[model samples]
Target: MAYLRLFDWYQTNKRDLPFRKTDNPYHIWVSEIMLQQTQVDTMLPFYDRFLTIYPTIQDLARADIDEILKVVQGIGYYRRFRMLHKGAQYVIDHHDGKLPEDYFKILKIPGIGAYTAGAIMSIAFHKPYPATDGNVIRVLSRVKMLEDDFRLDKNKKKLNEMNKELIENSNNPYLYTQSMMELGATVCKVSNPLCDTCPLQEVCLANINNVQQNYPKMSPLKTKKEIQYFTFILEYKEGFLMRKRTEDLLHGFYEFVQIESDSLNGALTQAQDLGLEIQILDELQPIKHVFTHMIWQINLYRGTISNITSPYEIVHDFSQVPIATVVKKQIKQI
Candidate 1:
């Protein structure tokens, strides 16, 4: 009864997303990868542009990694793009230019984890696999009145076992998996859930006990590490000086020279250490950029220099360059 009602609700209410128009594993894989830690609306433009650029797995495999990153630049989580490129190449080399249907084999691909592997297997291949994402976890936790810490491996294992049963018993595993995820995303949300409109409200243990907000229990959130950045957007002639990072974060992404210092004096000291004669034109409003675990308090400064004294790429046309999103915002302010 629960599965039947959920499917019926989904069929009538599901959003007509581009990815839902096909059962192709390749398209589904792209959507799932982009959906991670990103909102659907935020991903729509990137998804459409991405598919337009690389319409097929073979096309993706043949494309350059830098090109792929350029396409997905502002969307962030560049590592996912790297994995997508590598994984597509792997498929072309080993799987005949097609994504593997087997769950375990999908898991073997880099950046393709249990949830993503399960999602592709069930949604694209109609396999009886449970794609247990955070949405599924939330829905199931409320349905069963579970109170275990979600970060614990034992709890995740137990939840996966329960989802396995649900999928195995489902008459249409593909629809069932999508419907469950849809239900959680649209109705059974993390806060202020629409319990009255939820299909499983009648059987939901948390709803029955009037504790819907407390079922999916979790530990308190961690404090974000605070850091300061002094961004210097120095212009010489018609171009600005930009450089690619060799660090783990935002690797290969272009940005204006930034000094990691909290005070103006420190920033000036670092800028002088670069051995470049620069004149400070004016200061701009500070910008704040937040990451998953860190908060960047950015201090923006725009200036001019007579010549390029440092080894930095001179970018005259941004259309041809893939600038970091954080730096892009700063440029807009100038």
Candidate 2:
């Protein structure tokens, strides 16, 4: 249908990305995983550094998880990096250091899901399967003007079926798959689309009906739950005290000595109970950080301790802590 024409157009117009030049499944898989929920511009440097350090699946599999986390420090979603490390080990140990060509086997890995598997299969293996990511979903929904919410099961099924048909009918499945993604990213954008230059504009229902921006209706997002955290930047003669968050939210990451409190006075009392000599150095302005489903209002406190026998351990170097950007910024300001 219209995707065939778009595919033809893409062969001449597609951007030259590093992953497109090689049929190496390891490289393709790594790029695909990093590309998820991360912009290409932001991922470029990280991808280069990652490939330089861990050139193969075996290298990544054998590398320490903490080292990998350190390399991918600011990218956020620390769990994805951990899962990638685990998945690499799984592939090497179970599949003999080679990525599995079979779709089901790939899906069995710790973090590889349907979309990632589909992408690797088509791009690396030249399979006819389509990668139904958010970009593909947007392109299809606007082309056919699907009214149902895409997040719902029924519409998702329909979109998957349509994506399969589109890929199966195309002569060059790899080019077609990449084309659909490129079209959505460059021309058929989420907000203000360049419909005039889109190859599918003639048949696109959204363009013909003049409702390109309104197609693919989305459900309202749930409001993020707000949490107030009192961060104590307790400094001794040698260094400052910090802790690694072991919880699921920011697991394996570092932060300042933090205590959840409803008010500032309560937080100070709690810190005093922990035997920390409460000396207020400075009360900085409140800092706000947002996660996927939560908002954090962190209040920073800088104080020095004469006695080094408190529960908090002193970190001599700031670079050792795998602190997120928000905490790092706060520390820098203090």
Q: What is the Cα-based TM-score of model 2?
A: 0.95
TM-score of each candidate? 0.96, 0.95
lDDT of 2 by residue, 229-287 (tens): 99878787768876667788777777777889998889978877887666879887779
lDDT of 2: 0.84
The residue ranges of model 1 lying beyond 4 angstroms of the native Cα positions read 309-311
Q: Lowest lDDT 10-mer window, candidate 2?
A: 304-313
lDDT of 1 by residue, 84-158 (tens): 889999889889998887999899888799889888989999999989888989999999989899877789888
Question: What is the lDDT for 179 in model 1?
Answer: 96
